[model samples]
Each structure stands twice: as structure tokens, then as C-alpha cells.
Target: MARDPYRLIGRIQQVAHSLRKKSDHLLIDSAGVTTAQAGILSVIAGDPGCSQRDIARRLRLGESAVVAAIGRLRGAGLVERRVSDQDPRAVALFLTARGRETIGRAQETYGVLNGLVLDALGVGGRARFAELLDALDSAVASFPDRPDEAGPPGPD
Candidate 1:
């Protein structure tokens, strides 16, 4: 039997989208925070003094998108920005008390969602699935940034 790789990839994307949509609903309803904001808060919580650029790179998001999310999070009193001690020109991000609480809730929501996914994969498949995902991520990370530059020769 022949395998259709595109169909498999589409299924993966659909599952990811569904998971994000459901988790976003739960997060917004319970913690009053969007998934994007929760994600930024998580990154800040993990790296207390991380810069917006670092967040953008880690999240694979555009600088402008990160900036807008940070603005909304700051306006909502969930995050705070301060001048970096080492780099005066750069800004460091930190979570507020409210942000901490929200992140805790977000973690719980993620835990539940992860459990569902893991269950679907079963105990034996879970580890292998995780390894496959990590491998795929690593491979994708090595690709050229611009689609136009993605031709056979190599990145310009």
C-alpha cells in the first residue's frame, strides 16, 4: 500500500489546531488569559529575565506579534517589562503575581490536555511519539528562514 505523506501531515496539523483551540477556550474561561498570553507568561516564568527577542525566537513568532502580545499582557497587569541590568537598551520580561497565578492554571490545563493526548498514544507509544516530534522539530529548525531561499542550493 502506498502512503500519502501530505494527508498524514494534514492530520497532524488538524489535531494540533483542535488541541490549541480547546486549550485556549479552557484557559480564557478559567484564567482570563488567551493561549498566546499564557505561552508568553510560561516563557517568562521559565526564564525570569528573558528579553522579548528571546521570547520571539523561542516561540517562533514575529517580533511585532510578540510586541503586541506583550503590550496586551502588560496592559492586563499580568506581565511587566523593565530595563535590563546587563543591557541598558534591552528590556527584560517578568511575570506579576497575577501572571503567576494564571500560569499555574495554564499548566494545569496543559496537564489535562497532555494526558488526553498521551492516553490516545498509549503508554508504549508515548515515548516514541515524543521522540519523533523532537526529531521533526530539529529537522525543521535547520530549514532556511525564507521560502524563496529554500531551493536546493542552500540558503543565501
Candidate 2:
């Protein structure tokens, strides 16, 4: 009998959860940065001068949550905000020197975890996993935008 797709998906998600937990623990142990902080830093590193709104959208997080996270990062001297050149009313975000160094360390920690995960998959399995992950991502991206798309789903 064929396996249920939903069951398989649930198993995959459980595996992901386990891996993420381990990764978060490793980050805290090695870099002293929380997973959430590291993720925000990575996003800022990729898109310097991004608006808080854009950051929230990309991370699928609440605008207020993003703001709070940014505030924390700013307080830590890891991020800076300035008025957007294109929109005077909008604030743009970027990493400070300290933030850049922290992000670099975070990336190294992530790289190690990634390498371990990939190695555990072996060559063929890794390639297939990447292909499937990409296909799923593309499929989700192609879906039509919903009314609540501007913000993340409401809290359950």
C-alpha cells in the first residue's frame, strides 16, 4: 500500500523540528545568539537598507514582532536604522560593524550544521532532497496571493 502523503509530510516536519532545535542550541552554545536574532541578522545582511515592513514580509513575521526584534538588535549595537532615501517617511535598516561580525559567526555555525545535515544525507540523497525542497518552494511561491498575504496568518 502507498504511504499517506500527509503522514510523510508530518514526519518530515518532525525531522525539521528536531534539526532546528539542535541548530538553535548550537547557535546559543557557540555564538551566544538566539536563532531568531541570527535569522534577522542574516536577512539584514542580504538586504541592507531594507524597511522593517520588508523584513517582516520576507520573514513572514508580524510587523510589531519585527520592530521589537530590530529594537533589540539596535540596542545591542548590532543594527542601525535610517530614513529611506526613496521614502523619507520610511525607515531603512542595516547592520553595524558588530552586527556584521556576529552574523559572520552565525553563518559559520549554520554552515557547520548544514554540512553535518548534508553529509548525513549522502551524495544522492542530498541532491534529491535539495531538488524536492526547491520544487516545494517554487510551488508555494507560485500560489495566488491571498487577502491576508501582506501579513502573516493571524495568531491561532
Best by TM-score: 1
CA lDDT for candidate 1? 0.90
Clashing pairs in model 2? none
Model 2, which residues run further than 4 Å from truth? 1-4, 141-156
User: Any runs in candidate 1 off by more than 4 Å, and if so which?
Assistant: 1-3, 146-156
Model 1 lDDT per residue over 1-117, tens place = 886886987888998898889988988987888788888899999999899999999998899999999999999999999999899998999999998998999898888878888
What are the RMSDs of all candidates, in order? 4.0, 6.3
Q: Write the per-residue lDDT of candidate 2 for residues 92-155, one digit (tens) a residue.
A: 8999999999899899999998899889999889989889999988987888877565677778
Q: Note the Cα lDDT for every prediction shown.
A: 0.90, 0.88
Q: Give the least accurate 10-residue stretch of model 1, judged by summed lDDT.
A: 147-156
Which candidate has the top score in lDDT? Answer: 1
Tell me the lDDT of model 1 at 45. 100
